[model samples]
Target: MATGKYISYLRVSTSRQGASGLGLEAQRTNIDNYLNGGQWTLLKEYVEIESGKKDDRPKLQEALQLCKATGATLLIAKLDRLSRDAHFLIGLQKSGANFVAVDMPTANELTIGIMALVAQEERRAISRRTIDALAAAKARGVKLGNPDNLTIAGAERGRIAGVKSIKSKADVFAKDCIERIIPLRAEGLSLHAIARVLSKEGILTARGKAVWTACAVKNVIERIEGL
Candidate 1:
């Protein structure tokens, strides 16, 4: 249940939808139900009548500013109601305002940031690995122009297998670390406290660092939970 102050942001793809209270009313109801049982206060609500593809949302910026100023949450009915751009969501975390989507209320800036990092790292790692494999295959005399060559197809398969192998290793490590951290979290330890405990107990981060940050702990927690 929500228990703090919140500023709601509602969006409609067209002016007619806004005028008729079609999408807006449903979003408002969702927010109301989310806040129904909590000692929560809805400070203000901002409406935006624009295409989702448009990024220059003046009302969203205003709501964010208010959320930052008042230390209240930027509440929304659904994540899609906000921009689906990864960079936009990352920038929202940097705006120093907390936000919660009714559809994924358990998520927060910390978790969002962790998720972004994992996605970014996965993309970069796989890209680099695939590129490296191509370079290696070329060095081993696999002609790029010969699509008819069985060796070329074999190299392509090898590249895909390498990508999967690397990802599987990363996943296994995260799963192992998260398994250990779960009981500490269940015991009500703060994230920072858990990090300290991990460090003091000689636990290493997913990247093999001897120390752990609160963000790292959050990343690991979300990693295994997501799986």
Candidate 2:
């Protein structure tokens, strides 16, 4: 068996599957079975515990990033491990990832097109079933539709916190430069003029670099404003 770099992706649809590790183990076994004495390098393995209802899986995104950065192909034990939706399959195909689904070895372009049609029909069937269920519930005076926050508020908070942290760091860097470096330069000195002055005076940046740039000066000023 000949192989290059590959990234393995595994997902379990429910907490039960995740807790038992049934889905992940089975998928791993399948991948191992396929690799069977092959010259393949498993670059990374990404596991996610999430419903197949959506595609915004964190581990999946990480796997894709690794694949893209390393020029590796993505390997999944089964197609349904990604999603049952055909549009999702099409989107994956369009994402520039070379995919190998163990269960769908025969899923060429033709099979994929046919599956897309079948998926559309399945969506229609699901819609019809929902309408029928809604009618039955209305007959019994039952209400539905639960509303909740979809976006992770804590994740947004973390982002805000990170921005604040960076701003603080940048401000400190700028303040030190302005208080010590700028005034010396404002005395009729250019960037090169400042560099020569600093070097002759045996002064150096925090990085111990003697060279100076106009951009560095500007960056310090911007950071002071951030402070």
Candidate 3:
């Protein structure tokens, strides 16, 4: 039985889908099902219309910030709704916000890491296939460069900037948590005890989960000690 505050994030790939509530409704239903029997509070819900290929999701950034501030877990109906890009997903793991996919409630860092590698490989394969197809088209005298391509390039640049900005903010939040952990350790508290103290004090883990484990507490300590 799960118990905590949650921030739900839902996304759809196109404006049509968003407007028609096509994919959005199913996502909402899945999330509703997951939280049905759990003693939890839904702090907020953010719905976004955006492609998974881009990581510059404004609503997602807002959800993460809220998670960091309020110690609320990020809940999504599916992993793909969160992101299909391995690199983005990996970055999210370090973003100081806790997230769970309704489709894979038991997934942990190890499971996500393996999924990240596979997603990365899949992205590389797609890139290779696209390049090959483009070359073949060019060989056949088909025009390739266009204003649309330039627009896409510009969007990609914006996505990179947005990702960096969000990461910077997340790093600041992480540093604050580490600072708090260091002082607690200096007070002669063991990792397990420190975790309990943090929870009692309403200090959440990186993922915004109220409960903390010794390993999680140790990770914060190690992160700070490593400089």
lDDT against the true structure, per candidate, is 0.75, 0.66, 0.75
| Model 1: CA > 4 A from native | 81-83, 114-227
Q: Which residue segments of model 3 deviate by more than 4 Å? A: 80-83, 140-227
User: Pairing residues by index, what is the TM-score of model 1?
Assistant: 0.47
In model 3, what lDDT does residue 187 have? Answer: 90
Q: By TM-score, highest first, what's the ranking?
A: 3, 2, 1
* Candidate 2 Cα lDDT to native: 0.66
Off by over 4 Å in 2: 80-83, 136-227
Extract clashing residue pairs from model 2. Answer: none
lDDT tens digits by residue: candidate 1, 141-196: 99777454358787888789999987776667676677668899899999999999
Candidate with maximal TM-score: 3
Residue 119 C-alpha lDDT in model 1: 52
Pairs with backbone N, CA or C atoms under 3 Å apart (clashes), candidate 1: none
Model 3: what TM-score? 0.58
